[model samples]
Target: MIKCCNYDRKYPMAWDREDFSRAYRRLAPVYDHGLLLYELVGMRLRRYRREAVAGLHLQPGDTVVDLGCGTGVNLPLLLGAVGPTGRIIGVDLSPEMLEQAQRKIDAEDWCNVELVASDMVDYVFPPHVDAVLATLALATIPDYDSVIRTIASALPPGGRLANFEMTWPEAWPDWLVKLGAKLQQPFGVTTDLKDRKPARSIQRHFARCDSSERYFGAISFCIAIRQAGTGVNV
Candidate 1:
């Protein structure tokens, strides 16, 4: 039975690291290609990813952290944003996913990038970070709100973070919402995901939060800003 698919639903499920880790480990090697295959579903993920990074407007020397950095698909686009002097910290709970990401780092000889195998809930933020990027990720973490708070306070004034994710349409009928949940089950998407609202958290923590939806409201991308320092530097 589907409850109302609004963002106000109570008691969403928590992140089950063991189960999701196993699923992602198995999917790690194919993850990069796997996302692209969603093209058949009319998701232009590559383009969306590029736009997500571009929204950060990171400078040549800024540091950025990528949470749930599966196979490091966002690394290249991030590298392009910050240039050679910037640092990237990619965090994930799946070692297999980190391994695939490491391969990308090695293949490109990216000396400034670091990959850590840790859940985003426990991952620590480094100082002097100018931005954070989480693409198709935050909704999967049960404690994403806490993470958002940490980023908000730790970032030097005006630091940026981008969230790009999958979501139900704004006004889906109950039957359609149920069908959508069923179709997403194989990818580990759950009904409780409907209750996760990272944007609201972002709005609560950051001084400025700007968001837009695309793909018929099935996708939301938000860029948030902390208070104090201006854009350009951290």
Candidate 2:
């Protein structure tokens, strides 16, 4: 049941097959240690948060949701950007990750973040959100269509969704990106989804979308805006 579009075993909050549950369960204990390398290298976490906020043009009162918001690396940056008037929601599938996220939120004394444990593919969202951002998380969900629809449905017309994911860049040499991604696959990160299916799916569901690639094609982001005049009454 666990096959990468390419990669698992089961535990609490595992959203996919039995393998995923087991893999995530094993990962939970050392996930932070494994991720520390990324944090140290090029300050990837900080950069992703910076890029996510900049892409969204976030405002003081806007509401934002971070799907698959593991350990809440982006929450502090987001809280600063949105300020006291705005709200932030962090949704994740792992209870252990959410515990880490809550610790980060408390350490920063942020009062506006609400972290929920849920699967990104089928989670129900509030009626309106100004923006949705997920970093290094979207490529994990193979059911891209349902995930995109859920994100789209959560936004009001004119709202935005910006996602930063590991992707292989079409413009760059593919071999290098693939090799780097392969090295990282064991830690629950991969670039296979970023190729065409994820990109095409976004364009099909959204009126306008764009992306920026960084880190020698190791990181990429997609930004989409809901049409303001859709008349769907978000």
Models, CA RMSD each: 4.6, 5.0
lDDT of 2 by residue, 85-199 (tens): 9999998887777888888788878899999988787678886688898877776666766787767777887788888776666665556545665677555545454443455
lDDT of each: 0.80, 0.71
Winning model by lDDT: 1
Error of 2 at 195 (Å): 5.3
Model 1, 1-234: lDDT tens per residue?
A: 222223333333544777687777677877777786678789888888888898888999999999989889999999998889989999988899999999989998999999998889888898899999998888887788988887777688878888988877658775666677666654566667666788888888888889888788888889998857542211
Which segments of model 2 are wrong by more than 4 Å?
1-18, 29-33, 39-45, 170-182, 190-196, 230-234
Question: For model 1, what is the error of residue 61's alpha carbon versus the real structure, in angstroms, after optimal superposition?
Answer: 1.4
Model 1's alpha-carbon lDDT is 0.80
What does candidate 1 score on TM?
A: 0.89
